[model samples]
Target: MKEIVAVLGPGSWGTALSMVLDENQHEVRLWGVDSKQIAEINTEHTNKNYLPETQLSDGIVGYTDLEKAITGATYILFVVPTKAIRSVAKQVAALLDGKTKPVLIHASKGLEQETHKRISVIIEEEISSDLHDGLVVLSGPSHAEEVAKKDITTITAASGTDEIAKKVQKLFINHYFRVYTNSDVIGVELGAALKNIIAVGAGALHGLGYGDNAKAALMTRGLAEISRLGVAFGADPLTFIGLSGVGDLIVTGTSIHSRNWRAGNLLGKKVPLAEVLESMGMVVEGVQTTKAAYELAQQKGIEMPITEAIYRVLYEDADIDEVIRDLMMRDRKAE
Candidate 1:
């Protein structure tokens, strides 16, 4: 059955996902804050700034009006940055004041800075449960550029309930795009968010002229700390080995398409954090996530050396080389 889906955020990932829904024969309304971009998407059938090479589908419409974009949609996919999730959810909740609830699915990955809350927790806190059926997280190693070109990609749709996760699985699954359902929402989300931090470290290693052996070692040890902190926060350790975990870490850490990796790469070349952010012109989620994770680890008394090292590089202006030296000098321990 065809459904009306609202994809909020006109970024590359959101635009790519809108294309996916269009491929599934659903009516997609892509909502964004920029009216010019929205008009371009509606009239020109392209989002040059984001998906410059791909042509958008006719079935997908762009909207700047938040209420109109979501008014009658049966599903809402929030693809905005983590920082914007709360405000967007509040707006959606207000728009759905007395209307039927829609299924809420988010693809953003990050932990809230000060509060250290997950994306779903932020959304749930702002939007009353009455206005939404359930919260689901769609995550994996899939990249927007590859997905836009119809590349084979697999991801996970996780919710507290199997029924909700399966519902999302059906909504997105297709030949080139495979969707798996997982009941470990906490694990899935943590794996999705935490892997980006490791990716930054991976990119930094590359930027510093590190060879395959060093990169391999970094990834192996990075996953260890990620799983350690994740387990401390009540996430299943096995999820880290799955798509949202090791899978995401591999792609995000290695792929040039990843904004976080790119940012770290620039940092490795001795670029300032502000300069890197300005040059990229997109959110580098791992930077903020590193800070949040470091804080969370300290608060929870969890040992996460890689996360702490990245935090020092990003926040404390520590020299990347010195940080690497300190990391290497740490006492040896069993894997």
Candidate 2:
């Protein structure tokens, strides 16, 4: 069945997602804030800024106007970063006929820096939750590059509503992409957001000349820290052990293609945060996610040593060498 899918954002991830849906035979309207990118997608079907040679489909209509993108979109794939999610949602809210709009499927992974709010909370605030015909999270270990190439990608479509999650699971699961249905929305989201924080640590470890053993150790420890925080936030403890949790952690923490990992690598190489961000050319959710996670950990009194260490490395200008030394010599406690 062909569905009307609107992809908001034109970054690598967004363009990749839009291309996937278009190949799935859905009418995809890929909206971009970058005028040049939009022009390229419209005329040349290429967004070189993110995807260098991947040409989009005729079914994928690239537009700049908010109204033009959401006019009749049945399901919106919100692919913007955590910071831009709310603002973009607000713009969509103003342009949408709230009484009849598409199911807003958040494809982002991170808590908002300002309120530590999830993407769904922002949607509820921007548009009434009661009016949310469907609210779902699409996340996993899959990267935009792999998905764009039609590689076998597996992700979860989690929602409170069983029917909606199943409906969503069907739309995304194709020959190359597989979607699993899960009801643990909180766990799924928490896992997705938390992985990026740890990926930075992994990248930093790599930057410090750490090998696979170090990456594995950081990934496992990061999972524990994230699972602890997720359980504190009322998420299913087991979800942290599942696809959205450990699966995503392994992928992002190890992959150089991961923006968060690359950013951390840059930081480890003595590049300033500002310079690293500017060079990345796209929003690294982990940068802002670190702030939110630090806030959450502080508020909940959760002892997230890794998260705190990363926070300090990012914001407080704490030397990575000093931080690693402290982590290695921390107060001894049972694992």
Best by TM-score: 1
Query: What C-alpha lDDT do the candidate models reach, one value each?
Result: 0.92, 0.87
1-335 per-residue lDDT for model 2 (tens digits): 99988889888888888887877888889887778878888898888878786767877788898788888788888988888888888887777766665788988999987789888778778876644578899999988888888888889999999898998888777888888888998899999998999999889888878889878878888899999899998899999888899988888998987999999998888889999999998888898899899989999999889999999989999999999889989998887
Reference-based TM-score of each model: 0.99, 0.97
Point out the worst 10-residue segment of candidate 1 by lDDT.
93-102
Candidate 2, TM-score vs. the true structure? 0.97
Question: Which residues of candidate 1, in runs, are more than 4 Å off?
Answer: none
Q: Count the backbone clashes (under 3 Å) in each candidate.
A: 0, 0
Judge candidate 2 at residue 277 and give its lDDT: 96
